[model samples]
Target: MERDRISLTVPTHTDSPAQQVVQYAQNKDPPSRPLQNRLRKTLFIAMPPKKRQSDVVRRKSRQSDVQPGDPIPNRGKRRYRPGTVALREIRRYQNGTDLLLRRLPFSRLVREIAESVRPRGEAMRWQSQAIQALQEAAEAFLVHLFEDTNLCAIHAKRVTIMQKDIQLARRIRGVWGGLG
Candidate 1:
């Protein structure tokens, strides 16, 4: 197994103020060679291993008694908020056994569908279509399920100063003009 490795190293030469300004102007994106490399490696490891020419992950169906709409948890995050729940659901649809994958993001969902029925050509074709449908459903669920609600709700909270200024303003209809 490959171990995690990140080498944080400062540049050998320090840039003077003028050089720093020039470098900043010339390059809008800062260099993070080490960080980027680490990220790429991390993603590679995070995803399931690639087997043969194709990578497939299939979960056998449960007993006839198991109900739909329930999902196995594979959130990989703090599942305290709705956004986190949505994220976990997305991860499930993208990667595991869940009825919600019925909704999903198109391309990613399709790739997964391809993997599901890969062994049988005809079945694979149908699975592809199913995947597309599932992805759309999953994407929809992620978007609406996490928004305009408790978890991802963004309501503006105004700070009001309850000083005499507010009381006086309410009491007076008069403006800054000559007193009426």
Candidate 2:
């Protein structure tokens, strides 16, 4: 098997700024170079052979440049947008399981929904447990939506989730009685 090697000549002078930079860059090793007052010493290092093409990364091919007159091919499905990284991150953060225990921003909306469900004549002030329960339920709902949508996207061999993925997730999760 072939091996790679690198050799560097280093000076032992303590006053040279370039030698100081090299010393700082490789601080883990002791200065084993010959300490001759006037002569420089050579340092030999052995490195492993270069990796094969299979060991190196294989990146996706970029789209070819198209002229204005070129007609785009008709792929049945529309491609996902690449610029929604922040939106996906926010969705994941909002759907985090920890949010179920903490206060949710939509707690007020939950309270209003609760108020609407109550009988018209009676005044009902929501208790802390009721609000907490509503918040937890909302969090669970969001988590389910995000998780199901992610699964739907993965099922279609896509990294980015599209609107169709969400719609399919809603159907699979029986959000609207599985009409689809």
Candidate 3:
């Protein structure tokens, strides 16, 4: 039988002549203050003094510059009678008020539903209010499902509802008749 031997190599560090020169350069002190003062005097010049504000001419304030307590000048006049201008204003107000309504409008709901389902395949078109009505219906369905699931869990003599309880609840409610 042959035995395998392993050899270890250790690294030895010795400072070269260039390293010694670098060490000596690092230890050397900076130049004396007299040389620094002479260099600054020769290389740098003093700047001219700035003029005082009182010596310069004062600028008069323009009409465009608004002062404190200045009443804002009205740019446009309001219409008193129901003219074309009044009708346009009324329409703008109605549109703004409609946007502030709590329920999502029919057109916006349809657009949102279309955007959500677009990635499934070719875009499916739906009528206005369809998505909003569908959402309300689904909410009601979930409420009923949760109630039925709670009852199922109670009937099974369990306080905590499990997946099996939900499955049994759905079976009792016949909600997934066509799902299979």
Candidate 4:
């Protein structure tokens, strides 16, 4: 009959602060299980009906069993020859071709020329054009990168805001209250 623990006939959203009294009364275990069991006994609940029902509905979601002695389908096709033995001729030809390419001096010259043109003062007209093209390509790449990053960050911020709003709504029972 105490005011804090009292219940009224009509619903008004206010919970009593008398829960601490129940908490202190329990020594090691809470009596919530007994209270819940009593509640379930008194309540006549109906489940929401499913739109469709089938014989295999409850059973089809599980993995099909494969017995130990059963011959696995496509087992022979799964076998792959070891690459070291199977690709021996191809590997020998690749090594020979790689050695031939290494013997050529023009590729190394192209690499050196590529490195030298990087300086603003040393860059020739063609070199500068190539560098400008590279710069343009890099700028385009960066613009897209930043745009995606900012978009993702903005989406994350919006999600955080929505979550805060939901939490705030829960705390105040649909009334506006600051996030807990």
Best candidate according to TM-score: 2
Q: List, residue by residue over 50-80, the lDDT tens digit for candidate 3.
A: 6667535433345447787999898897756
- Candidate 2 lDDT over 1-180, as tens digits, reads 454443444555654856654764585464565656434344444565766765443321222355567887887876558758778888887676465444655666776776799888777676878778767766667667877889989999998889998888887667453222
Per-residue lDDT value at 173 in model 1: 31
Each candidate: how many clashes?
A: 9, 0, 0, 0
In order, what is each prediction's RMSD in angstroms?
A: 30.1, 19.9, 25.3, 24.5
Model 2 lDDT, full chain set: 0.65
**Per-residue lDDT for 16 in model 4?**
38
The runs of at least 3 residues in candidate 3 whose Cα sits more than 4 Å from the true structure, single-residue gaps closed, are 1-122, 126-128, 175-180
Candidate 2 displacement at residue 10 in angstroms: 36
lDDT by residue for model 4 (1-180), tens: 112333222212223324533443454343344332332112223555544566356455443455568786874555557676557876775566233223225344554676686775563344544544554554454444444444554656752234444334344433532222
**lDDT agreement of model 3 with the native:** 0.56
Quality of model 4 by C-alpha lDDT:
0.44
Candidate 1 at residue 102, lDDT? 29
lDDT at residue 134 of model 2 (Cα atoms): 68
Q: lDDT of all the models against the reference?
A: 0.46, 0.65, 0.56, 0.44
Clashes of 4: 0
TM-score of each: 0.19, 0.40, 0.30, 0.20
